[model samples]
Target: FRGRRGDTVKILWADADGLCLFTKRLEEGQFIWPAVRDGKVSITRSQLAMLLDKLDWRQPKTSSRNSLTML
Candidate 1:
């Protein structure tokens, strides 16, 4: 992740047709990050939403809706 606040980066991937890019940026704060295990980070859907919103994902105000995980 970018160290500086408001620094944006694009993720590039290739699909069946062609290359695709997705970009996400935080206007004010750093994204809430999850602990990495075995060089990978896994978080719940709710955590992702909170992270995207620049909120603290470690302790959510509401309970998690699903036990499923995301990377």
Candidate 2:
């Protein structure tokens, strides 16, 4: 999130005894920030995946695949 359009994103992380940094850039669509509070917020692994795909994080699960396979 340190770069602009067509640029690169710089992500810095720190753990127990090590520090890591990474970068990524999207070819289209602006980055969509998730809801936040006064302080930083975190999401679960499944929530993160939905956010990256720009889908509703709170969507209910359906069994459409089960019906389709039965047809």
Candidate 3:
């Protein structure tokens, strides 16, 4: 996991064949993280998608009520 000071982190996971490494970094800003006293925290699918897109995943925007009806 990355630190609050814009540190780079590399995570290794066990795959079916071998180990897989995933790296993440921010060029301009730091990644939004959850405030938890525990060592680990769970993130939602939407949060993960936002993180991958280099967005702040902490505060997710709610969907608008307006919708288009399909004919």
lDDT of candidate 1 over 23-53, digit per residue (tens): 7875655665666689766677777667667
**Tens digits of per-residue lDDT for model 2 on 11-69?**
56799999898766667654444456675556687775655555567773666666644
| Tens digits of per-residue lDDT for model 3, 1-71 | 66568545555669789998898876667666656567776777787667667667766666667666778
Instruction: Give the whole-model CA lDDT for all candidates, comma-separated.
Output: 0.65, 0.59, 0.68
Q: What is the clash tally of candidate 2? A: 0
Clashes of each: 0, 0, 0
Question: How displaced is residue 15 in candidate 2, in Å?
Answer: 4.3
Model 3: residues >4 Å from true position, as ranges?
A: 7-9, 62-68
Q: Tell me each candidate's TM-score.
A: 0.53, 0.47, 0.62
Residue 60, model 3, lDDT = 61
If ranked by TM-score, best first, what sequence of candidates would result? 3, 1, 2
Best prediction by lDDT: 3
Which candidate would rank higher by TM-score, 1 or 3?
3
C-alpha lDDT of candidate 3 relative to the true structure: 0.68
